[model samples]
Target chain A: AQTVTQSQPEMSVQEAETVTLSCTYDTSESDYYLFWYKQPPSRQMILVIRQEAYKQQNATENRFSVNFQKAAKSFSLKISDSQLGDAAMYFCASGANSKLTFGKGITLSVRP
Target chain B: NAGVTQTPKFRILKIGQSMTLQCTQDMNHNYMYWYRQDPGMGLKLIYYSVGAGITDKGEVPNGYNVSRSTTEDFPLRLELAAPSQTSVYFCASSQWTSGGPAYNEQFFGPGTRLTVL
Candidate 1:
């Protein structure tokens, strides 16, 4: 079975600063996909970014990027210039075949 | 387009009661899924359907049932609700190609909060 883990239960960052959220997964399959999803208080699950295991270059969308180390089975999300809107629960998810597995998640709070 | 929608945004159920959570997607996506979300625990897949008439159990399938009769609707049923089953339920849809890409990207709907006493 595939499993995802986010060690941090909660994280706080000052506005305009940078914050990194860590994630790790256990999967026997060589090919898969990694993702970071954000959920605000509205209970909406929004996709933040995604990384393919086959790609060596990290994926970046605006200020959100990932540091994926396949050998170490680590995938971390980096948010730059964090804003108040960035305060939410961030989840790391892994998908292979038709199943998507999610971590426990980290609650992020931004301070102005 | 209304990508995905779930009815009854919030529901409170009594123990041993039964209810069906309705989910509909207008995207005509080939893949649909039901997941339960708990605070600090992220989300757990309850069931998934690759397409109409092809449903399968996921990690936490116990106490839940699902059916995909059409391409657009995948309703989840709880036969006898328990306190443990009280959580937010989300309906998600996506398209899949044989090789990659689409297989990983999923569109999620606003979740339905269910409380079982």
Candidate 2:
């Protein structure tokens, strides 16, 4: 079974600071995809970033980036220069075989 | 484009009641998916469809059903509501590729919050 784990339930970061949300996944499939999604208080699920397992280079989308260590099975999301709008629930997911498995998610609080 | 949209932003159901969650996409995406997010938890896949008339079970399909009768619509049915079924339901759609599903980035709807008593 494919499983994604986000150990931290909650995280807080001061505005303009950087915060890294930890996520680890286990999958037998060699070729898969990893994603980080952000859900704001409005209950909308927004895609933050994505990384392909075959790619050695990490993925970055503006202020959001991923440190994807395939060998270690770790896919952590880093929010640089975090702003108040960055506050939300973050989810880590693994996609393989036409299915996606998501972690428990971490609630991010941006302190102004 | 509307991308993906789900009807009934919020609904409440009593035990043993039934309801259908409607989902639609305007992007002409061939892949549609239903997922439920429990409190303090990430989203769990309930069902998915690669195309019209073809649906498959996902990670958590129990007590839930889905049908894909057209390319634009995928409605999820709950035959009997239970408290355990209370969660925020999300509908997602993605463009299909011959290569595989890994390359597709799913677009999600605003989500429907369902509460079963």
Candidate 3:
């Protein structure tokens, strides 16, 4: 069974600061994908960033990026220059063989 | 595009009851999925459909059922609702991009909050 783990239950970062949320997964498949999703108070699952297992270059989407180390099975998300709107529950999900598995999620609190 | 839409935004059911959660997507995505988000837990896949008339069980599908009669609509049915079934249900859809990782990129719905007493 494939599993994604986000060790941190909650994290706080002051505005304009950078925060990195850690994620690790165990999968036996070679062809896979990783993703970060943000769920706000509205309960909407918004895609923040994505990474392909075959891509050596980390994926970056504006202020959100991911350090995906395929061999180590570590996929961490880095949010830079965070804003007030960045406060939300962040989820790490890994997908392969038509199945997507998610970590427990980390709650991010952006302090002003 | 409306993306993925789930109906019955909030519902409360008694034990042994049954209900159907409606999900529809306007993006015409071929792959649709059902997931349950428990309190302080990761989203668990309940079921998924690749296209019309084709559906498969996911990680957690023991107490639930789903059907895809068309590409746009996939409905999830919960039978003999138990307290453990209470959770936020999300519907997601994605288009399969050949030779690409787009197949794993799923767009989620607003989610349905279900409570069982």
User: What C-alpha lDDT do the candidate models reach, one value each?
Assistant: 0.93, 0.93, 0.92
* TM-score: model 1 vs. ground truth: 0.97
lDDT of 2 at B75: 99
lDDT of 2 by residue, A1-112 (tens): 7999999999999999999999999998877999999999999988899999999999999999999999899999999999999999999999876668899999999999
Model 3 per-residue lDDT tens digits across residues A44-83: 9988888888889999999998888887999999999999
Docking class of 3: medium
The sequence of per-residue lDDT tens digits that candidate 1 reaches over residues A24-70 is 99997778899999999998999999998999999999999999999
Candidate 1 segments exceeding 4 Å error: B99-102
Error of 2 at B98 (Å): 3.9
Best by DockQ: 2
Q: What are the DockQ scores of the candidates, in order? A: 0.66, 0.74, 0.63
Error of 2 at A35 (Å): 0.9
CAPRI accuracy category, model 1: medium
User: Share of real interface contacts recovered by each model?
Assistant: 0.65, 0.74, 0.65
**Judged by lDDT against the true structure, how good is candidate 1?**
0.93
Per-candidate alpha-carbon RMSD to the true structure: 1.1, 1.2, 1.4
Candidate 3 lDDT by residue in tens digits, B75-106: 99999999999999999998875566534578
Which pairs in model 1 have colliding backbones?
none
